[model samples]
Structures are given as structure tokens and as C-alpha cells.
Target: MEHFALAKEFPPASEADWRAIVDKALKGAPFRVLENQLYEGFATSPLYTGAATSPARHGQRGWLIVQPVAGASLADAERQLADDLANGATALSLDLNNGPAIRKAAELKAVAGAGVPVFLAPGSSPADAALLLAKADKTIVGTAGFDPLTVFAMSGEVPADRKAALADTVDAALAIRERFPLVTPFLASSRAWNGAGGSAVDELALTLAAAVAYWRALEAAGLSREDASRAIGFKLCASADLFLTIASFRAIRLLWARAHEAAGIASNEHILLYAKMPPRILSAYDPQVNMLRATASVFGAAIGGATAIEVYPFDEAATEPTPLSRRIARNTGLVLQSEAWLSAVADPAAGSAYVETLTEKLAASAWALFREVEAKGGLLKALESGFVAERLRQTAEKRERAIAHRKERITGVSVFPNLNEKIALEEPAAIIMEEAHPTVDFALPAPGAGERFAALISAAARGVPLAELHSASRIVCDIIAGGALDVARRDAEPFEVLRQRADFALASIGSRPPVFLALLGSPSDYRARSLWVQSFFAAGGIEAVLPEEGFTDVEKLAAAFKQSPAPIACLCSSNSAYGELKGAAAALKRAGASHVYLAGPASLLASLDPNDQTAVDRLIYEGCNALAVLEEAQRILRVEELAEAAGLEAEDENFGAFDEA
Candidate 1:
């Protein structure tokens, strides 16, 4: 075989060469334009020249495809579970909060028989854990899902008897370990923080803090450091940001290892990382785009070395998951694994300078935040003092502002929206109620039962209902100062509200709130701004009535606007055209335009209306507060009021000096 060195044929490109090329492409723009500053307090460089000498690896070949099943009844759950298992899901997550009420030992055993691992999401109650273990197959490896700290953070309440509840959880975990060694009893999850719009740093810090709290609790209960570490697993949300998600997962592993090392534990055990797709990024407008998001999330999770991955159904935001949606969600992981071979390598992102650097930065930031949480006396105390809530709020507000200004564009919501998109959603499955049965009288466990798990499991085997089981371990804590971490919000929620208002107006009247594009000169002169203005308004569900042809005369454009039903008008044209037709805004205002908007920046306003500042009521340009502008337009057009007073004209009150034109 002939040997050829490609490196010798092509000289190594220096950083100067790259900068020269980039500078040419950027024209006069600064090189910093290519860099991006993340919410985690780090900037991403445009290029990386050095290679990482050593990088962490996932140390595993593939991840478990965990399918989360939530149904109205046990039968429904069984059906979905069977279908998911058959279609390549390697594990199952029972959404106890919304899924079937698995009360009896028989029900738990039946659902657990899929021959794959079962992760109890949000964790099972102490009593529920007992019931799960009473009939669960010992060979099945999974988690008991007893995560009280996360539950407290999410609900903004601590158990009135916090110590007893936590002690009971520890006892339940110990029992699960004795019966099923492969099953992890505790879960440290950051879904609450992630769902609350926390940054990757927030999620990592919170998870580490919560896990430390659990480790201390477990250790105090006579478990060794290694035992406590082994008994718990981690669950983190994998978002659409691919590189960030990868770095986040990798960073957590490093942090966990560091935490164990600090505790003087020399265990080489890998952390069980379960990466779940977050609902915060899911959009109901264009639900199909969620599939792409899910794919990206799965890729990130797999590359970053998740032990298990769960892909949320695309239409879950709009309605319950239909069978088709469930299959698509399940297949998303299967295709990536089987065809894309995403999981063929351990820590696929390892050795990439960008990923390694990001991982190190994220780990450092998260560790610092974790220490801050510790200074507040741990995750629970931080939540109690509203420290966690405040931090999450700050990040959430920053992210919201970015989305509102269109700085962070959301497809189909803030960017290219489809106003006329008839979303094809399958009708939600009808809830099947279980037939009422005679209530069974079962003696409740004492307030401080010695072995709560044993007592609960014995009671469960006697057919006691889940309600009675939960009543014995119910958490009744005080709500934090602010309500539960601001309810999970999507990036598209604000714009979606605007669309909803538009939909209501359309149903009440015959059309959506309209904005007329008062185009000037030839199509080439105004086409760019015309289209930009149209898409901008359409994002808010406001219909843009574009002129059939650009007009050179201001009177003709104003006459066309007067015939249209739009109460608001935006002048769209090139700077030269705006300078040529300086009377367009005045003419449109005289023709009954309630408000006039210029499509370009404030600089173009002087060309359109040099004498009167109010001639152009507002300017719509890139980086402007788009949501605020659309909302102001809605208020001016009275879209909400139009719903009640359909066909009634809103009197123009802001005609200004142009009224005499």
C-alpha cells in the first residue's frame, strides 16, 4: 500500500490566516461579532487551535432509550408500555404524577414486567416505593425515584415534618437496596430548575447541591460514602443547544467525581445520568419543529454520555401524546442510535478543544454556584430563603427579554411564523375511568413508624389503595415567599398569546387585526422591507395587507390604504425611496391610519418625516423590542375589544398634524 501524508501536502493553516479570511468576510465588522457570550458567563470563540491533551469519556458504548409513559388508567399505561418496549425503548419511566394510579402490588408487578429497567419519575413516595418493591422483579435494574429535595424545590414547599419524611425516604432507599441492589433509591434531578428557565450552570449547581444534601442524609443514616453515592442517580434536562447540552452533561460527571474525591471516596463508578428533553423549548404553533429539537437533544445526550435518554413527544405541549406522536418520539432515539450511530463512541465530544473548554468552564462555574448553595445551608434552605427562586427568575427574565427582542429567534413563533398553518393534531385519547370498587379499610402507619417501608409494603400487599398509602407519607410544607418556581414557560409563550388574541378577533369579526404595508416606488425599492414588515407582523398573528404594486406617488398609496380595513399602516421602502416620498406617512395618517410605523431604523425616520416626530409613531427594525411593538399595535388596534364589539369601527384618535393633509 502506498503511504501518503495529507498534512505534508497541505501546509497547516495558522490563526492569522483564519483571521484574515474571517475579517474579509466580516468586512468592517469586529472579530468579536463571531463570538457568542452564553448565559453561563462564558464567551464561545469562533475558532480553536489547540487540542485537548486529555478529555473525559462517557466510558459506555450506548445509552438506554427510556420512554416515559403517562396514561389515564392502568390498562392505558400497559398498552403504551408494551408498544414502547416493542418499538425499541430499552427502559420505561412511569409518570406517576399523571400516569395510572398503580395502587396494588399486582399492578406494580404487571407494569414492571417489561423485562427492562423502570425509572419512577418525580420519584415514588415512601409508601409507593414499598408497593413498587413488594412485587417488582429483583433482576430489573432501575431507580426507586425517591427525590424529596427536587419535589420541595418544584412545589415551593417542604414537608411540615421534613425530618420524618426524609428519614422515611432514606429507610425506603435502604430497604430497596437490600431487596434489589441494582435499583437506585434516590434521584437528584434539576428538571424544576431547567423547566423554570434556569441556565445550564443553574441546573448543574442545583443538581450538585441537592445530591450533596442527599449524600449527607444517607451518610448520617449509617451508609458509607461509596454506598450513598451508588444509591443515587442524576437526572438533568437536555435542551436544544447541542454543544451546551454536551458540555453540561460532561461537566456534571466531572463535578460529581470531584465531590466524591473531596469526600475521600476513591470509587471509579460512573454516574447514572438520565437526560430528559425539556418542555420549555417546545412550541405548540409549529409542533413538528419539536421533532428536530428532540433529535438535536438526543444527539447531545448521546454524545455527552447519558446513561438513559427520554425524548418528549412533539405535540405534548398542545395535547396529550397520541400513538403516532409517541412512536415518533420513540423512533427519534432509535433512528439516531441505529442509523446515525450517535452512541457508537463513548463521549464523542471528547478531545474537541471547544467542547473540552466549555466543559471546564461550565464545571468551574457550577462548582462555585454549588458552594454558594452550600453556604445557604444546602438546596432546601436555599429554596426556603428564595435564593434559588431569585437566581432562576433573573436568568429566566434575561432569556425572556432576548426572545422578546428577537435576539433569540424561535422558529414558527418569533421568526418565520405560519399564520395560516392548520396544525394537524390528533384528537387526544379519551380518559378511561376505572370502575369504582368498594373502599378497603386499612390501618394507617403511625406518624413515626420505625420501618415505614416495611409497614407500607405489608399494607400494600393487603390491597390498600394508593390514596391511603400516600396519606401516610404525604408532604405538607409551607409555600415559599414566591410561588413555585415560575411555572414552566416556553420561549414562544409570549408570541403565542398574541396569536391567541388574533385568533379570538378573527372568530369574533371576519379577519385578524390588520396592518397595511404602505409600499413606495418599484417592487425592488421596497420589496425587502415590505417582506420583513409582513413577517414581523405575522409573528404576532397580525395580517399584513401588502399593496398589489409599489406606488411612486404618495396619494395613490394613501388611497389604497384608505380602501383597506387595516387601521394601522407601516411605510416600507429603501432609504432613497423614503427620502423621495417624505409625505407618505402624512398622507396615510390623513387617510385614517391610526398609527404609522416606519419599517427601517430611526435614521430613516428623518427622511420620511423630518418636520414632525409623530409622523412615524414607531420604527420596526432588527433588535427592536418586537413583542412590545406588536403588543402596542394590538392595544392601538383594540384587537381584544374588537372581539366583543365585532363590526364596530374604532375611532381614529391619533391622526396628528397630518389630519389636515
Candidate 2:
């Protein structure tokens, strides 16, 4: 299991206390006494002192929260934009969906408000670009235009006059730059790398290299290095890995600062960092799980230092997210800001050893990769030569292998206890293409590498190995190709179902403590008793996953054993009953679980027998020895790292700002 430490300085004596804090804090309650809002205050202390800075403070204005529109109706998009603007969204991502939508949104002058920037995502049409500019300021626009090689790959019948099709993207970009001085519209879109399964580091390195192409292309067109540097921005992925996300963004800006110096560009101004939600973590089943994913992504984005974050709606795992999902998507940023209080500070990761070490490692790795891309004649050439794509293909394959082996656990879809709840998606789906008017003048041909990708992989069609057959005309790197069938070979053996254990173990040790405490009481008493049990668990670890109905009966006991400690146990029950079930508890004691509590009258402790074990250890009373209990749980976790954690203390702060460390 990946190990984690709860920032040794923030450490409580036991896992229960640590977890209790997490639960209390995450409940959106006030825990500002210990950590700063958005994790900022305690950053300077020794334990958290070395933590790296969070993205929240990277820019004085804070990261922009954006949402994109693809193939959605202009009216719908305009409405969405209006809603986002009203709901605290930092920016707009217009589709041009087409010319009419562009025209329609541009005409809604009051909606955009003065100076609220709009960024056109990659692959945007010039006409749509013109429309966004007309409506509001769009100085730093983003694009997914095919890089020269991609253009080359897609270049089937372009006339020699339009050979400029490749060169003209820059020429057009320059013209727009002169007209819109603040605007930096070029290649920072995910149309290539992400659509093709690239790694986070690869994404950063390749995107930087591609930007180098625009610089070289513009330099050839008589634009100086300064202007070229001004034209490119970066859009990257923010998945569930918090440090990885932060490192990727840090690497980009750090590289950009260096590359600008190499290219003779003045000022470290204008390297836009655009981060987007990753589709890889999304699951089609019980789509609501996506909300959790997007939340983590946004949190990662905030920590990673994204200048702007585009939250993919929860339903984006398969279909276009509807209005409701989109609203949730936009509101996620708000929730993080208002409810979660994420935007109140900057560089929230600062002073953590793990985040700091990881940042340096990632930056170093990405830097080396960037140099390699440059060695291969820059990103465009790297793409054309299949080097970048092939390298990323390997990383993606490795990740796929890990998932198959069960090294990576995807909740709900993978390892866990079973559930039989029927999930019928009652929500409506959004239109695929309402305003997808990409405005490139000359028509481009097929994928320079002619292969198609799928929208989603169904359940039954998983586990089949990929077919490697390819035609000469295809961009056929077998390593980079998808499996022939939908079924994916698992990283581990398929899970087998079994009946749950009979005896339940009640363990509680962290905020209240994390012992898989069993509340073997009637439904009425379940809630009341479980409260103390949960408090006992939280005083020890992460938040508890309470049973839905919160009851522990015969069926419940069996179900609990699948996850909880084993052997049947009870809380607040009589000694006679406790002694009657000692055999079951004894058997459970032999297996794994071995505790039962009375929570009954104090007189019972004195009356219990030797086998009934009137021993002080057996009939311990609550509120009597809180300190000893706390000490014991700490010893337990000190040896175990809570199963899955970053395992380092305060790794984020070591950067020393501008590489002082």
C-alpha cells in the first residue's frame, strides 16, 4: 500500500485523532485553528515548512475556473456562459459551436461584463475567434490547431499555395496578435496528446515542444522570439494525484521561464497555464462518482498551480454533461472557493517534504524530456517522427497494466464489497455538437495517422488484448494503439464473491479512532451508539464510511465482516449476553476481530467472571482512560502508515522559491 503521513507537525497522537480532524475539517466546519484556510496558515512551521507552494498563490489573481462548450447549441452555450458568469466562474470557453452561436453570444453584450476574459480552446475557427474578440477581451486565447506534423499527417490534398496551411497558423496568429495586443492565441489544446492517451509529464513536455514549433514558425515568418514566446500557452491535465498535478504545472512554468531566456524573450510574463479535468479517472457507472473525481481534480488543480481550470462535468465520463451537471461543474470551483475556501490563499502545498521532493523530481523529469524533444528538432518534429507519441504510449500502457493488475484501485468499479442497487440514469443527455464551429480556412484531411478512437468502452467488451494490425496509411504505432476488443485484460484476477463473516469486530483507536467498530443494536439505538463508535474511530484515521442504514444485525454483521474486523461483537449489551457470545467472539478473536464493549452499568465490570474475563483489559469503561487509548492507537499507526498515503511529511515547501534549495 502507498504509505502516508499526516504532516508530522499536524499529527495527533493516534490515527483516530488525525482522522477525526480530517472528518471535522472536511465537514466544511471550521478547523482554521490548526491549518490555514485552504491549507495556508501553518505552512511556515518546520514539519510543513518545506512544502511546495500551491497553485492558488501562483498568480495574484488566482486560478481561473473555466468550462468548455463543444457541439452544443449557441443559445444553450450562451445560457451556460451566463450561468457560469453569475455563479463565480472566472472565464468562458466558447465553441463558436459555429458562426451563428458566436454571433449570438457576441451580441449578448451585457452577459460578458467588462474585462471578463474569454479563452477560445484549441482547434477554434478564426471566424469564431473574431466573434469572441468582438464580444469581450480575448487576448490570451487557447487553441488545439493541428501542430505542423499533425497538419502534415492530416494534409491529404492541400494545394501547394496552402502549404501555408502549416505555416499560416502562425501567420494568422501574428495578425491577430497585432490587432489584439493582449491576445495570445495558439496551440495549447488537448486534441492530440490527451485524445491519444499521453502521460501527465509527457503532456507538459510535448506541449512545451509544440509551443517551440510556433516560435520557430513565427521566427521564420519574421516574428521575433519575443513575439513567438508571447503566442504560446499550455493546457495540461489535473487528475486525482495532487502532487503530480502540482508538479506538472510547476514544470511548465519553470521550463517556460528557462526556454524564454534561451529564446531571448524578455520578461516572465504571459505564459498561460490552462489545466483541464482528465477523462481517465471518470467512470460511466453510478456517474455521480464523477463529482468526487472532479472535486479531487479541482483540488489537485488548485494545488498544482493552474492559472485556469476547466472542470469537466461529472457526467462527462460518457455523454455531454447536462445543465445540472455543468452547473455542478462550475459550482465545484465555487464550492472549493466559497464552501471549501480554496481561493483565499496561494501555494497551499508549500512546506510539505513529499510535495517538494516530487515537484523537483517531476520538473527534472519533464525538463529532461523537454530537452529530448528539442534534441529531436522540437515538439512538431517529435510528433511527426512518432517519438513523443510512442513514449507516451508506453506510459499509458504501463498505467493500463497497473489498472489491470489491481495495483490501482478504482472504487465502485474494482475491489470492494458488492452492492446491488439499481442505477438507472434518469437525467437527460446534452447535445454533442451545438456550436462546434472550428474556423480554419483551408480544409484539413484525415488524421495524418489515420485511425479512429472510441467514445467509451462498455463492460462486457473488456479484457480482450489489442489487435496490432495496421495499414501503411495509418499512424500505426502498435504500442500506442487500443486493444482490438472492448474487454480489457485486468491488472489482477477478477474478484470473486463470498458470504460475509458472522462475528463482528469493533475496533476504534484515531479522531474518535478507526477500529471497525460494530454497532450491534436495534435500529433506534444504532444512530445514537454509532456516534460514539465513529468518534472513537475518527480519533484514530481518515473519515469513516458508515453503513447506509447504520444497523448491525445478523445480515449486517456478515456484511460488515467483508470490510470490518471479524468475530461477532456488541456495544452497550449485558455481560451475560456478552459472555454467551464469548465463543463467537472467541472464534473471531482467533481470526482477527476480538473486542466487545459493555457501555452498560459500571456494576457489571465488577461482577464479570475470569473467563467472562473481569480483567481490566476486557471490561474497560469509556471516558476513563482517554490518554492510554490515544497512546495505543498512535503506536498502531506509527507502524502502519494508514494503508495508503504520500508517506512523507511536509514535502511541498522545499523549493525555496526560484530554486534556492
Candidate 3:
């Protein structure tokens, strides 16, 4: 009887109510419910499924959640490392750049400890990784920038002939065999290709090309095949495309092992794969979406059989990852590993028909690309001819065009749009870096054109990397060799212009008092506050347009909505008018006004009230609170664009105009 009674009294559903129901389904406990259902858990792929591989070797224990800590100042960077460690971050990855950089591993070493694994990115010299390793207790798990492809990639200064001389730059890429044997050379990173605009297939091919270039260079430099095999490493980007990412990584091991075997240096050992989310795809709008994206990326990496993963904060592209964002990003992996027990199952995707089919396709396509790179004289040669970079540019253009057309939408970003997004990106805590926070830093001085002497002092005193000034062209350089046909061009995209125009107009989500007049008792109440309030709100640009009969609830008010739509409908009547109005007021405003409130004697109205005021989801009394909320909703609902989409005006003569806030 109680349940039945409550059902009759229950309030109508609100947006919040719907959200609660959906959220329960999204993160439902027990993962799989017999009554409800199960969203498949994240899974990975393995190379050998049916065939025998020596007993499952205790493949590397836990891998690092390495977050690159290279920042501006030594003090700031040190603080950054401490903060990263405090969060679930397991290690540090340094980014070494030439031209005014600190390279003070010894000085920064004071901040890191024996517990954290410190590694350097591939572009850094082995000496830098060695320096970091010397300071930290863990072995540096990094690669050398010594392959011919690397030389060609960084060939801004080196001559074509002499570029080969930098071969010993990172000890021919094989020095890891003697000292840091577990170090990765190019066994799993394809960032160079992926970041530039290369497709998933292109990434694998280019990495293979780079690997071949490394093998040739290392062999020429007098290294054994085994050493060369142990020296290379690979870095790849994980994305929301889970199947693609898993297929990509699983294919890397299979293909790389095949490449090594073909080169007469096959090893049963698995290649180290460090997967990170691509910064290029990260967006500043609806920054919270970054968290969801990163979570998906982590899932992809875990199931893709990545040896390690670096889940950068969603804000990585927009700004530095804050302690809170970093903690969340890091724990994302920890949660998957511990509570989710993802690591318990290896190559969970191995047997799936789709994954196996995708993996084989990727491998075949990558091998084809690898052969093409060789035909073009290898990765470095492709770089010299701008082949690879040009190819990447074209792909980047295609992606941009897709976004413009809305064929591929980035929610809360390029789509599901919100303009004038005020994103807050906290600067990394001072750990001992080179420069202050971007929000605090002043104007960038003229590149190379600025005073050289003064620049040296500012850079030295501040930790400004000089390369930042010289690389301005990289920004405008159409990564696509040929200018891509701008898919986002004006004629090509109409919504782009519309979206931009509406964006030029701002929204006032702020609160304001409603326009209302005091209701006079009895008949004077007929010319009551409701009449004045409706006029005042409309005149003041509030959405609510109450009518004389707007006071009634449901069944009656349905007729009012049939007349013309208004943002809200206020009820105006005297205490004695209650019996004639109360139930009607509740019925009319039902499923109608964005908000509704009342005026007059509360006690008198209560006596005549036949239906629950709470039924329609709200009951505003004669006060500022209800009025303020109503005004705010009117501003947000924004129903004034009555005929634009219908094109009562333009009809293809011209595009419509955006609403002015």
C-alpha cells in the first residue's frame, strides 16, 4: 500500500533523474550482472595462440607509467617529479633538446629517488639516459636517436654526407647491449610517424624502415646482429580506436620478430612497446572529455599488449597535467591492473576473429609500406625528400577536413559544440625546471632575430630552450607536402560558418531578478503581477512569456502551449481565486514552463490545492529564489531561432544569422 501510494505521489522525471539511471548502467558494479548485462571488458592480443611458445616466460614484471618530466626550471621540474611520484606515476621520462637546455641530470637527480624508474625519450643521446640512470637507481629504459632515419629527421643542421657521422651519437644504437641491455631502441615507438599524420599502417611501416636503417647503421658501425636486435625500441600512440590500437601493437611484435628473423637475428624475446596518447588529437574544449579519452586510451594500451604505457593527463595538449589530473590518469592504469585484474589475462584478444583479421591486415599493409620505404631509399632518405613528412601532412589535412564536415566529430570540441570555453590548466608544481608557467611567462621575444647576447642570458637564467624560437616554421609548415585541399574551406563547410557565427554571440548563463508586479487582491489581481512579470521578463530578454491564463497547470495549459510557445508561464490569482485555479495551474504548467512560480496567500492556496504542487517537478513560492532560477533557464533554453532552420528568410538566398546574447 505504501509503495502504491508513493507511486501516485512520485514527481515527474527530470534530467537529473535520467542521468542517474544512465550512470548506474555505465559503472554498474560486478562488471557483469545476470539481470542486466555486461559491456565486454578490455582485452589484448598475443602473437602465438595455438602454436607452442616456451612456457609463458615471466614476461617483464610491471612496466612504468612514465610521464615526461622535462619542464622549464630545475626547481620547477623537481617539484613536478615529486608531484608525479605522489600521484600514481611510476617513473619519469626526460625530453632532451639541444640549444639552451639544462641537461643537468646531476642537479635534478637530487629530487628523484631510487624507487622511481627514470627513462629518457628516444631522441635523447644515450649519455643523457646514462646520466639519468646513474642518478636514479633504475636502469634507463630509453632508445638512442642514432638510426639514419633519426639523423635524417634531425638533419636541419647536418650535411647529407656528414649526417652519417652522428652515427656514434648514441653509441650506434647498440651500446645498450653492454650497459643497459633492457633498454629499448626502436622496438615499439611510432610517434614520429603518428604525430606527423601517418596512418596506423604508415606508422608501423616507418618504424620498420627506421629499424632497418638502425640495423644497417649499427652493423656498419661494427655491432653484432644480436646487439642490434637488443638495441631498437618502439613508441606508439594509443587511441579511442581500441581495435586498431590493439591490432597495431600485436602486429608490431609479430612483424618485428619477422623482420629480425629475415635479417638473420631472430629472438623469441618480446619487443618493448611504450604506448602514449597522441597530443595532436587532444582538445582544449570540454577538457573533462580528455579524462574519458585517456581512460579509453589506457584500456586500449592494456589490451594491446603494450609493454608499458604513458597515459598523459587529458590536459597534456592544452597545458601541463596538474597533480589531480595526473593522479587520475596514473591511477587509471593502477585500477585496471589491480581491481580490474586486466594483467591477469594475456593477449585476451588473441582468439577473436576480428582482432586476428585486423592484425594480419595491419602486418601485411605495414610490410608493404616497409618495402616502399626501402625502395625510396629508407626512412632517412624519405625524410630528405620530405616524403614521409609530406605524407603525414596530407593525412593531417584529411583529418581536419573530416572534423569540419562533422563526419568525424570530437564531442564538446568540434561537435556537440560549446564556444567560449574557459578551461583551467594548472601549471606543474615547481620541481626545478627552466622557465615559469605559461600563464605567467611574458611575450615570446623575436625568434633568432632578437638580441643574441640578451637571449643567452634570459635563456640561461630562465631555462628557455632556444629551439622553441627557431621552430616557428614548423607551426605553419603544411605538414602535407602539397597544400591539402582544405576540407574545412568556406564553400566546403557551411555549419562551420554557422557555428562560428553563433560562437561570436555569447550566452549569459548568469542569474537575474524576474520582472513582476505585485498582485492586487480580488479583481485587481486580474491585472496582477503575473501580467507585469511576463511583459517585464520578455522586455528584459528573459525567455518566459506568461499570458493571462498562464497560471493553470497541465490539461488546461496544454491548450496555452498549443497557442504559441513561451519560455515560461507564471500564474497570477487572488486567495479566493484558488479554487478556480490551483489544480488547473499545476495541470497547465505540466511539461510546459522551463520554470513556474506563484504569488498570493500560501495558506489560502493550500486549502484549495487539489493536486500535489511537487508533481510537475517544482513549486515556486512568491520569492526571489524561484524568479531568479526561472530567468536563468529562459536565457539558456534560447528558443528565439524560430524560423532559421526552416529558412523562412534565406531559403538558400543567404545563410542565417547567429543569435545575439
Give the poorly placed runs of model 1, Cα more than 4 Å off.
1-9, 23-29, 101-103, 161-165, 424-450, 643-661
By lDDT, the candidates rank as 1, 3, 2
* Model 1: per-residue Cα lDDT over 1-661, one tens digit each: 2787767878788889888999999999988988998888878998875666665556866889988867767788888888888889999887554567665777876566778888888656776666666676678688888888887777777777756547778878777777788888888888888888889999999998988888888888878888988888999999999999999988888899889889998845477889999889999888889999999999888888888999889888777878999999999988999998887777778789889889999999999999999998888888888899999889888998999999999998899999897553344555433344334455544433236677887887777766667766554667766757765678888998888777766665556788888888988999888878889999888988877898888889888988777788988888788888767888888888889998887786555465435677888999999999999998887766765665543344322111222
Query: Candidate 3 at residue 63, lDDT?
Result: 56
Cα lDDT listed for each candidate: 0.81, 0.49, 0.52
Best by lDDT: 1
Span of ten consecutive residues with least summed lDDT in model 1: 652-661
- What does candidate 2's lDDT look like per residue over 304-385, in tens digits? 6677787778766545567899889888877776777776666666656656655655566667888998898665455556
Candidate 2 lDDT score at position 121:
56
TM-score, structure 1 vs. true: 0.92
